[model samples]
Target: MTMRRHRRLAATLTALVALTAAAGCSSKAKSGDDAGGQGADGVKTGRGVDAKAIQLGVLTDMTGVYATLGKSVTQAQQLYVKQLNAAGGVCGRTVELTIRDHGYDPQKALAGYTELEPKVLGFPQFIGSPFVAAVKQRVDGQDKGLVLPQAWSASLLGSPHIRVIGSTYDIETINAVDFLLKEKGLRKGDKLGHVYFEGDYGENALKGSRYAAEQAGLTVVEQKIKPTDNDMSAQVAALKQAGVKAVVVSAGPRQAASLVGVAAAVKLTVPVIGNNSAFAPQLLATQAGPALERMYYVATPSLPIGADTPVAKKLVADYRAAYPEDALDNGVVAGWSAAQVFGEALKKACADKDLTREGVGKALLTLNAHDAGFGMTHDFSDPQAPSSRQSAIIQPDKSVPGGARVAREPQVSDAAKAFTPGG
Candidate 1:
């Protein structure tokens, strides 16, 4: 997700994030004064790392709006761990995750972080922009642990610890608006309707729409909604009355579906685009399927699931075999990609002979233009910036394995590249 990052499973799906806590590590890693020792490999260890294994945290939404999406994300992360451990682990140590199912609750998310903070080295998959931001001070000031969140709000950027793996929501939204413009979803002087959440995720995206509208010579019609609100009938009515040409959805899958479905029933047909988490494969089986297929589009950093690329093929096969019941989705790719980056940093830290939290953070900065053979590549050298400012436009297609196909390749729009997240 530039999603699977914020609001209730929104952007939960601008979306890819999740995983569960394993029962325990072979043995819990030492923390505080008890942490940091020499491993058999002569690697220096610290909190979350011991002679046997290293621990990370996964604070995710499992029972909330993005439950299904979260499950897929978590499973893929688990799958990555399985593969990594089987391949001799990292620097003579196995990797473990302290996963918490926050169910998209703010208090729960905060509590989960509080509980896991001391026990883990860092968090590879914290899913909410607001939730991640909630603990930003501790992470940056005190904990100094590395974090790769599923959310993409610009507010989380400019921190050394909380590194956004993809473009932030504001930048992703700018790229999305660029997609609409290039595809003729909207032209000059057209009014582009934006339906978004009132929280960090949606508000950040709204910023981008405003900027893009100004850059592209268009008017923006705004509609604010909460994550719990599912009926988009009223919002659709308002956008229709405004005579908007295209619409941008910066919420979750449910909101997108409702808005698209409601708009269709009212014959307010128009091209609708969303941040990454706004669309999911499961929605294709619902009443919104036809409408989503006809008009709904999503912008994300990675290629859609079941893409023709080698990485996608292998992942789909392995995932389907591992969990035959779970359908393929882009969440898998997002989860795997994030986990892989974490692994890369861990490997660099291990090679540096310092698997401490700070060591891992430093290792990440050394990885510029890191490519995992997916559709996107990132430069983590600058903490103040997102790794990349690019998004691929995808359209829902029931026939595809993930129920979606790429409408555009991953690229940073001139508007997006020039735009500043906090500017």
Candidate 2:
């Protein structure tokens, strides 16, 4: 062979290498296009989702009964979205959060939902039980978007469109009753007082109390009130006269403070356990702070802030950095946890390149024992089963970030397991 023959062979090899490189580049580009492509039905993927960003809605109370709790929830959602965006976002799109204050009003929540439904992919903070109840039908039937409701009522657990972050209020109350009987040495025949509102939130809690009472062979003295009622003196006096051993309250923070203060004034020295909605930092600053310190216990779905976990530590630090003037509130932690679950669902939906409302709903239904951080886990595999049944009992302590100290770790009690929403 001569030098000319060697030159021809080298040219052939160079041409083959160039052709192979072109094919590789084309395959990579096609994969990227497929990820960002339309669904099989040729419909747009998701509402409020585009090439640049995905928008989420928040309907919370900023100036109503649970103002502090609602505001903290909004802030926590913002912080989570910010962190997610900084970490390159989900499916290569930034997360944009839009918040609206319903002021704990059902009408206002309905209006806000109508306004935001067209613009957001989903809701991370659907605040009030009443509000969610008011709009549940429309949301489920018409809007058809995924919603992470702040209220964990048993009634809403059956809705396919709503995602609950923690244990239902009824389950929380059941665990609270169990905690009192086991930890506080309350006897089987002791009279337990139940002070609750009149709606589903209150009624659901009452159901749990009744179930636990039946199991423990205790008597429950009931005192029902409206959310508009500010004074609980008469209710407390009734419980005091009945010689109740312990009380379970399912009301707002103001009502909680009122009940505690009135109980202290009447010399009713008994443990006052409330549902998760009953505790807030503002209660610690009110005149009932001392009474809350003495008798207040809250049963919640997640670990208190400052728990020894990577997720908890990061949440505390991020919350403090984002809002320096505000203390760490469990409402915020709850909001962050909701966002985490929503993010997981979003990732799952995107995996199939179909980020529609139906896709998100399907993804949520497939979740099995998903750890939502802060020592909480959820199983959505069965639509009929409650989202979460684990709860922890905490007592008010002004020193902790969430203004409560964990008296018990999260556990799934038999009472919770036996809980049937409206049963």
Candidate 3:
């Protein structure tokens, strides 16, 4: 009786101990799963966001024709994220930024997007219009992430998931025409020349120029150029022969310099205006620097970084402190402003603790008349409308921080308001 009873008791005790340990493991697993399922604000999250941080991507051109601008963009984005993290990031979660260079190539941009699609919540800056167009469908359809593209084309106005921070190229060109006609005293039937790249950004600006020319009773002489073209001498010579009273350019810095420099050489003393992307601070260091200074006006969505505003001052100080070796440029301001817009949207998305891609998209659509202290306001309330039609005219001045000074305050021309997208 002693041996049999002792053996049965020992076996029962061992079985009970095993059952207790299994129950404890099951309970711990349940707790861990619950925490992982919820965000910091106790709401369910989507891709690129977790309880501790939200990850975003930046698609830019670091080794292309726009490399200087791209580098500034990357730097400003980093600075903005750093400041945001220091001030307690969105929804109590640290913000992580992943930057990928696309070299201003559509294929490279697509590849970068493919790689970043699964890792980031959204893209704060997609640098090129052509690149954005190449990946728009994938980004808007399957990826389901919000994208704020650096390209401001009217053609992009209808996308549900894309947010534009400033005026479209079309509207900016209309303003340029207005400034040239009214302020610069160009008469009716005068020939206005336009030299542009053969892509969305350039085409959109060209459309605006054409519309404005018609309205002002002026003739338009157009020359379509490619991104790779470095010599615009022939184009300038043709415009000069056509007796153009003014010229509007929609190209990058290299082409801009070439066009203006050649125009000056050929004794084409007409006023030259450019879209925002056409001017970079580095242009002043080229032989075209004198030509740019002779008569060049640039249409911009924001005041120059040299503007005497509190926000501009803060941006300059922070940018210089962060990159003392780099000169402050409009691209840095643009990048910083884009990040600010994204941060605001993130804050809105966190208001209800819904930090998913859908939440961020809705927040972006609700942003109405957001003033970044850049002397212009952006309204995202109407999805069918372009972000902002207002723009300021700037003339090149080497003394300025960004190599430009405000020539005209922010204004929305009647022609810009009446212009149609994709027309």
Candidate 4:
């Protein structure tokens, strides 16, 4: 699914320490010896920060599951770094990214983290939730570095080190179900079939489906698949056989496309709602395009890249100018917003005259109701709670700049509000 939609490590200590004198090395939050000297701005500096630049990590998928999203996310943040650097950066230190493409392999993801962990102050984008959950222990106990993942699994909540940017998977799914109910697409007696991945992302979403089903007096038809499984024929067959009125997908764009396309082929023409990572705008050009006409998905952490909002419009224009050849998607917003939040934390850290890894984490906790004119206010004060419970109900539209537009503005459903994080 959008792996953090978000997670995942690096190298030997001795070899790492050897790079300390050179530009390649970095360290965890620790004593002054491990962290380097202060910058010209007189702010205390540590790992990933030198008098000249601040290094951040980008661990993402470029050739697997979320390849399209990964590219946009990395590029958007890269654009942020460019703009920020042009503006003189935080505390006179430039922003640089140490990027690693994990290919969506868990082992490679961890290795990428390890290799880049010491070289960067923190990770602004880590693309898989399960990968993040896998290295949760290292992040909490050993690294203690800040990670702003693209993922929103409830299981990832409550961690001081890893902060999820939007409503969790369960919460978002509940909101998705609510959308179907409100639209009269589903009813009390209807069965909501949930086709989800087999890992943290899908299971977390499964929690929401069951909860919403119980609340609405509906039944949940379950179909579990893996990230590698693109064919939804069997799954759709089962869903149609079970007489499901609506469907919720908590997987990547591939799975969403397959489900919707396959569903249409089998004449199981029910409403299909997906999590944020479930749709990529590029799919609009494929054979599945017509089938996706009725597809609906949820977006959070930020609104779509092209909305009525001023910031959204500006971003769409800017991104087009920057990457004219690429297609627009929600990933650009996700990428930019994550970096925006991370930059705010850095500013706070600079203001406090402490730009260490630890300083950034502390600064981030103080950010609440942060408004970047993204049509939503994110409150990062609670680690266990999502920054925002609301998500925008979106539909695919080729006429739009990002290939989709908002159907309903961002809002939190009563059911989503009442949701508690657990499976």
Model 1, residue 65: what's the lDDT?
A: 77
lDDT of 2: 0.81
Summarize candidate 3's per-residue lDDT along 13-128 as a digit string, tens digits: 44443443344344444311122246545865777889889999999999997898899988999999999999999888899999999897555666677667666788888998
lDDT of 4 by residue, 52-94 (tens): 8899999989898899999999999999999999999998889
Which model, 1 or 3, shows the larger TM-score? 1
Give the TM-scores of the predictions, in the order they appear: 0.92, 0.88, 0.90, 0.91
Residue 315: error of model 1 in Å? 0.5
* Per-residue C-alpha lDDT of model 2 across residues 161-232, encoded as one tens digit per residue: 886777888889999999999898778999999999877789899999999999999999999887777899
- Where model 3 places Cα greater than 4 Å from the true spot, the runs are 1-37
What ordering of candidates by TM-score runs from best to worst? 1, 4, 3, 2
RMSD of each: 5.7, 18.7, 16.6, 4.9
Residue 409, candidate 4: alpha-carbon lDDT: 85
Between candidates 3 and 4, name the one with more favorable TM-score.
4
Q: Pick the candidate with the highest lDDT.
A: 1
lDDT of 2 at 11: 59
C-alpha lDDT values of all predictions: 0.85, 0.81, 0.83, 0.84
How many residue pairs clash in all the candidates, one count each? Answer: 21, 0, 0, 20
Q: Per lDDT, what order, best first?
A: 1, 4, 3, 2
